[model samples]
Target: MGYIAPESPISDYDRDVVFFEGDLEELDFEVLQKGMELGFILEQRQTKTGDIEWVARDVRKFVAPPEKKVIPIPTSTKSKANPESPVNIYPSSYRTFLEKLSDSLKSIEKINDSGNFEDAVFSLLRLLGIHSVYQYSRDAQAGKADGFFILENLAVMYDCTLRNPFEEYKKDQIENYIHKLSNKSQLTIETRKADGGRGSKTLQIQGKSRQVWIITKGNTRELLVYDSIKVKEVAIKDLITITIEHCRELSYDAEHLSSKLVMLGD
Candidate 1:
C-alpha cells in the first residue's frame, strides 16, 4: 500500500516506479501488513535505467505466499506498450504488485466480481501469457469446472475459491471435482480408442496431466497478486512456481464457490 518515492528524500535511484499502485494505497494497514509478513516487499523500486540506482534497505516482514499472482493493467486505458510485443515489468514493481493482487483474489473481495470478470481475468492472463479459454463457467451450475486452460496439451480445471471473508476452500470438494474431470477425460479417450477414434495415438496415454486451479470469488479492492509471483523463493533463489496460502476459514460466499482456472504455463 505504501510506495517509495525515489526522490522523496528516499534515494536518488530514479526508481520512481510505483510497484504497488492503485486503490491499494487506501487498503487497511493490517491487510498491507499481512502482505509484508508474507515476504512481499510490495513497494520495491527497480532502477530500470540508471547506475547507483537502487538498494535494498531492509527485511521488514516476510511470510510464505499461498496463491497465484494477480496483475491488474487497465485494458480500457492505452499504454505505450505494444499489443504484439510482450508486457514488460520492472523487477521490483512486478513483485510487489503480484503479492497484493494474489492475496486479494484469495480473500475474494466483492470488487473483483463487479464489472467485467472476464476482462479482469483475461488481463491477468495476458500478463501471465497463458491464453486460451479451456473452460467456461455457467455460475448457476455448481460442482462443475467453471473455467480451465489447455496448455501444452494438458487441460487444467479450476474450482475458483476466490471469494469473500478470505476462507480456505474445501479441499475435499476441490479434489472431487478435479478427480472427476481427470477420470472423465481419460475415459473418453479410452472409449474412443476402442471405437477407433481418429487421434488414437495422441489419446493413448497412461494418464493425462491435470491441473486444478482455485481462483477467488471476487474483489473490489486493489489486488497485488502479480507482485508476489515474481518474488524470490528462499530455497531455490528463483521465483516460486506455485504458491498456496495457509488453509483457514477466513470467510466464504456459497454461491461463488467454483468459477475459474489456475493457469500454469511453460
Candidate 2:
C-alpha cells in the first residue's frame, strides 16, 4: 500500500503530531520490490519539520490494476496427453494459496462436526487472504453487531447461523445487527501540524456505513422482508468458493459475483 500526502502548505496544517520513525536507507532492493509486488507504495509524510518522510498504505485503495493482468481466464493446454492438467491464470503463489484454502474449506463439514465453525471460518478467511478480520461475536447487552471485517474504508458486518433454524431469522434481527454495528467508536491516527510536527487525530469508526451479509447453510429467502433493506446471503460452501474465485477482489465488489452465488444454491 502507498499513501500521498495532500498538496497543501505546511503552515495550514494542524500541529502536534506523533509518528513512528523508520529508516529507508536500510532496505535492500528485494525488500522494496516485495513491498511493491504486494501492492504497496511509499507515501511522503506531511510533517513540516522533517526531511521527506514516507509511509505505506494499501495499494488497492489508490491504484486500480488492470483486470486482465490481475485475473486472466484459464486457457486450454495444447498437449492432449495431459489435457486434465490445470491451467493457472494467476501467479503461482496465489494459485498455491487458493489450493491450500480450497483444501481447508473442503472439510467444512468436519470443521462444524467438531463444533469449531466460528474458528474454522475465521481461519478460512485468513487463509483466503482477508487481513485484519475479527472473530465473530454478538453483544446484545452492549449493542454490538455479530462481527465485522474491514477493507480499507469499508466495514462488512455479518452474522452466521446454522441451516436448520434459518427461518427463525427475521427482519428485526437484521435491523438490530446493523444498528449495533453503526454505533460510534474512536480511532487515533497521525496528523501533521503547520510547524512540521505531528499530532494524533481521534476519529469515529462510525464514519462510514457498512455492508451487511449473512452466512449460513440454509435458504437466503427466509430473511427477505417487506422493508427495503438489502442483504447478501451465502451458504458455507458457496462462501468458500466465492472467496477462492475472487480472493483478490475487494469486498465492495462482491455483488458482481452474484452469478456464482446461484450455482452454489443448486
| TM per candidate | 0.30, 0.43
Q: Best candidate, TM-score-wise?
A: 2
Q: What is the lDDT of residue 13 in candidate 1?
A: 34
lDDT of 1 by residue, 61-132 (tens): 444445545445566553557533434453445546667756655342334452245334433443333444
Candidate 2: regions farther than 4 A off? 1-100, 113-115, 136-145, 169-172, 182-207, 219-229, 246-266
The digit string of per-residue lDDT tens for model 2 on 75-128 reads 553447765565455445666776886786777745544236755666666655
TM-score of 2: 0.43
Q: Which one is best on lDDT?
A: 2
